[model samples]
Target: MSELCHQAGDARGMEDLMVDYYVDRPFFDELVGLFHERTLAETRAALEGGVEWIFANCYYNSLSAGWSPAIFREVFVPHLRAQVELVHRYGARLDYYDDGKLDASMELIADCGVDVLETCTPPPVGDLDLRRAKARIGAQTTLKGYVDLLWVVKHGTPELVERTVAEAMEIAKPGGGFIIGSSDCFREGTPPENMHSYFQACLNYGVYD
Candidate 1:
């Protein structure tokens, strides 16, 4: 990744590769501000590099602790909008990833022209009503995911998992846009039996026919 960054003659080439490194480091206020600045700078560089799609990740767990809508609008939204616009200017699409409650951020996300919004978490934290999200975002944006990962798989029985998957398919799969998967990253402690049950459910219930 460092080699790629060097080859491209800019930091943008290695932006994705830096994710792990950033994860390991501590987050300070100065660093947080720097993070946003670097994101905008790298996004512009990526657009200039002939990239076709830009994956934009919004706030993670921090939103749950009350990163209010006003704070996002005043501080973060403009930078995100700029990134989306820069990508669009280069004929690319933006996919914004936010697993937190997006009720506050939806308008800003839409305003940024996000082509795809991944509702990667389930209800309470995210829009469990995939249909409503689609309606709200309208036809211009594609809605993806709303599966209850922790509830259906980790705690539920195999039969329950199967039933949940069947229900999810009935609601989320009728249309052409949705994709079914874990609501968040599959955790290590998730039982193997539950994992097996989840995949079996997907296989048994995910078919169009």
Candidate 2:
């Protein structure tokens, strides 16, 4: 693992400095970086680290409601591709953590040779029809995480959680490549009851037999 020193300042300056520091380092096996002004530098560090893969986190909501693929291509894709290529040189993969409807970015993600994409939200927010996504991306690339954080385990009843998990298993387990996980990172406010219920649901439904 490579450590990235994130200093306090404008994003652009920090990214530039980070890139300068890691462009020729020899200690890390993987490097994770942020997008924005520092994306390019982060990409360079991945190259220096001899990283097998890089992970990126992206989110789209009310604050970024207008986010688009065009914007991603212009501001993020160039560096993302570079980092991915560096990892590929070492026979590695690039995984992105995007927890939103990515209808706009799917094609670009495919073009970048990203090996795994995680946290795909369901309808009302995302366009991931699991069957369709697998068809589009093919067997080479993997899709991870489809559990609903807000509904299946947060506000829903135990019966609802169990049913939802059962459905997910029925749909996603048919394929050998899917991974089950929460839609996003766990939040502190998530009720313990809900958490226990969700896991129990998974335990009861996730078995392949």
Candidate 3:
């Protein structure tokens, strides 16, 4: 969908349409409605199966999707709130995942009652400043994933992995809401030694007294 939107060269206009359901209100209604319908059904099914976590991976990264604050507040926040409510009603948590810049949407994500927000990708690949994210929304939502999976994890040395993990832990570990994880998946060709270093560093720095 993102690819199609970008290919159409109207991503921002797409966001604007979401702002008002502009071009076709009924179409937009059905589209957003479909999302809620399917999402709620799956949430119910997962909870009934006794799962404790509902990882809702919305790949429409707000930054890349051309989301403005209006798009978030007016378009996405309500649906996310509904998602959180349904999940919490069943004694489950919603871990929302979006794989692009998250700096601007962190507060709104937390405000929508999401329990966990993953892949809070930091700069170069993403724009999240972990220290600020920790300060702002850390009290409300669990801050997950800041390591650069492609660079520091897959391509870089074990020493770099350990250093990255250590730096992340130093900032996000203090208050206990952070999870040391990758910005995205460890892709194919990721070094096994790097994986080892990642966990070793986790144990080394992520241990809480």
Which model is ahead, 1 or 3, in terms of lDDT? 3
- Model 2 TM-score (2 dp): 0.69
Cα lDDT of model 3 by residue, 10-127, tens digit: 4334565455466677766566666566667777888999999888766563755676777667767787788789889998888988778888888988998989998989888888
Question: Candidate 1: which pairs clash?
Answer: none
Cα lDDT tens digits, model 2, 1-209, are 11122321132343343353357322111222333235546655766777666776544311133434664565356655675676677776777777787656765766777787777677655666766766666465667777777776677677777777777777777756666677887677778877887888778877666
What does the lDDT read for residue 138 in candidate 2?
Answer: 45
lDDT of 1 at 103: 61
Whole-model lDDT values for every prediction: 0.62, 0.61, 0.80
Clashing pairs in 3: none
Model 2 root-mean-square deviation: 8.1
TM-score of each: 0.70, 0.69, 0.86
After the best TM-score superposition of candidate 3, give how far the Cα of residue 166 lies from its true spot, in angstroms. 0.3
Where does model 2 exceed 4 Å of error?
1-53, 60-65, 204-209
Which regions of candidate 1 deviate over 4 angstroms?
Answer: 1-34, 60-62, 124-127, 203-209
Q: What is the full ranking by TM-score, best candidate first?
A: 3, 1, 2
